[model samples]
Target: MSARFVQQLPHRRERVADWFARPGAVTRLTPGAAPLTPRAAAADLAAGETVFAMPVGLSWRARHDPAAFIPGRRFADEVVNAPWRALTGWRHVHELADSRGPGGAGTVVVDRIRARVPAAALHGLFAFRHTTLAGDLAAADRLAGVLGIGAGVGREPGERLPRLTIAVTGASGTVGTALVALLGTAGHEVIRLVRGAAAGPGERRWDPEAPAADLLEGVDALVHLAGAPIAGRFTEAHLAAVRDSRVGPTRRLAEAVAAAGTPVVVSASAVGYYGADRGGEILDEDAAAGPRTEALAGIVADWEDAWAPARAAGARVALLRTGLVLAGGGGLLPPLAGLTRACLGGRLGSGRQWFPWIALDDLVDLYHRAALDPALAGPVNAVAPGGVDNAAFTRTLAEVLRRPVGPPVPAAGPALLLGRRGAAELALADQPAVPARLVSMGHVFRHPGLAGALRHELLRPAPERG
Candidate 1:
């Protein structure tokens, strides 16, 4: 079977080509639901062989046809070896051309594939690819504008922003992985700070408890995402792990940044700083910390304060008071999505506690901005604007998945699993947080509504034609 998909991308042909040529482009384009996992880096996309790990211990190796590669115009790849190579064939060609017309000022992307898979079965994949491409390009454009690079300058469209060398902790985490890929595709150098010895190129050893003095040396910016996860039964050990990980390590990293005189530092924080059970109150970055009695609230407050060293040294620091992050690959969404799909999803407890949330991509973008945009400083609530209550969230998620709502989960359900205090502070917590700082800075959210955000992450059918 043969299939062709075309998309009018609002980016110059050269820009689109540059994105494809970048190291993390393939990763960004691949959907979370896709079975194939990219085993090759961006440098291996041309001429070099690329391998993909498939389910059931299968693998597919393909080679880019260097002879047919036309820079900034076209490229093609074909399966050189695979488990089904004898039973089926696979080849794909990517073509780019400048759009023509009175107001046309973009590129037309054409994807042609020859494979045994039916076009209908492949629609979701291509749709996801195009959506991701458009979003990435748009984000790059916005970043360029914010940084005052590209356009109006002599730089080519492909060079939207000056390349940056950013060092990131928690590089293997969900948010970190997405942020690193986004940065890599934007033509930035990413140095992952690993706990152990440096693994490969672009990785460096970092001791969170006592970071090396030169850890931030030569690094343009530092994104500190390392912290023990807060989700659990809220046992004494769990609480200690969460607090100890952030306060001490963050202070240590802040000192290192100050020592190295790193100009930019973006650290992870949480909206829980506002305390739990603040019903109906719209909290922004300016809101005071919730009473110290709240476990998470106290931990988050210390977490944000740990950056004092860096701030004192005059480095621009951003504390992201993040909310519930929604993504299909991991985090809060996957398990919730599974429950919703199984018709076991419903409102929790009173169903009236406010739930502040943000799309994973939006959170990544906020981090990217905080790292690059010097104007963004201090606490920034990283969440979608309109906050929803537990009941609303449950209904919206159910609607998105086209599943009926199951019976409401009684308050005791979470209390039994998380203990009374844990349930009250976590599963039953409420903080109607908003991104006032981001909004004031004219930040654009790709998915502002819960339905749309859920749809995008879950790879649901889109209204736009593919």
Candidate 2:
């Protein structure tokens, strides 16, 4: 089969092509909803080949056609080895051209592909690619504007922003992975702070308990994201693991940042700081923390306080009080998506509890902004503006998947699995949080509404025309 897709992106042709040629462009453009995971690839398309791990332990390898690589015009790649290559051949060509329509000063992206994959299957993939490209370009532009840099929207010839060297912990985690790629593609240098010995020029050894005083030397900013997963039974051991991983380590890192005099710090926090059961109350950054009795509430309070040393040293610190992050590849979405696909999706508990959530991309963008924008300080509520109830979220997911909702999952079900408090604080939390600070700062969410966000991350295709 052969297909061609074109989109008029509101960006200069050179800028769009430059984005595609950047280090993390492939990682950024790969569809999250796809089953295949990228195993290894060249830093940039011009470098060489890309490999993806497929199901059943198979691999898909594609080589970039160097002869066809035109710096700001076109590039092509072909699948040389894959489980399905014997059945069909595959080649894709990407072209960027100046928009021709009257008053149109943007780039027109053209994608042409030939493969045995069905047109119906290819449609959604390409549609997702185009949409992702557009969103990423917009995000880059916004970041430039936020930082008072050039190279976005309106720019003079050869004008660009100077890149910063950012240090990040938890670089392999979902959020960190996305944020690193976003930063790399946007022309910033990212240093992954590994717990073990440094791996490459892009990494540094970090002992969380007692980080070296010079660990953050020459780093423009630091994003702290290392913490234990909090999705298990809320036993004493599990709770201790979560708290111990965060509170002490965060303080140690904060001290290191203070000593190093890193100008900015963005640390991970949680919405649970406000108590899991603040029903109907719209909490913002200014709201008081929940009582210390609640496990997460207390832990989060301590976690944010850990940044005191850095803040006291005059470093601008922003605590990310994140909500449930929605994405196809990881986080809360995968299991729910699986159950929903199996016709087992339903509301948890009372169904009236507010679900404060944010798209994975939006969360990454917020981190990007927080790292650069000196004006962004203190606690920032990282969530979508449109908070939905559990029932509404269930309905939207089912509607997007075109599946019927199964029977409601009783409160007892989660309690049995995660224990009563775990279920209560996590699965059944009712905090109606909003991004009041983000809104006040004129932050723009790429996906604000739950339905639209779900559709984009889930790769829901456009409606068919009869």
Each prediction's TM-score versus the true structure: 0.94, 0.95
Model 1: residue 139 alpha-carbon error in angstroms? 1.6
Clashes of 2: 0
Q: Score each candidate by Cα lDDT.
A: 0.85, 0.86
Candidate 2, superposed: residue stretches over 4 Å from native: 101-104, 147-162, 464-466
Residue 74, model 1: Cα distance from true site in angstroms: 1.9
| Candidate 1 lDDT tens digits, 233-298 | 888899999999899999999899889999999999999999987757889888989988988999
Name the top lDDT candidate. Answer: 2
Clashing pairs in model 2?
A: none
Candidate 1: list runs displaced more than 4 Å.
Answer: 54-60, 84-88, 101-104, 153-158, 463-466
The backbone clash count of each candidate, in order, is 0, 0
lDDT of 2 by residue, 183-276 (tens): 8877888999999999789899999878987799999999999999989999999999999999999999988988899999998899999998
Score residue 105 of candidate 2 by CA lDDT. 68
Cα error, candidate 1, residue 291 (Å): 1.9
**Alpha-carbon lDDT of model 2:** 0.86
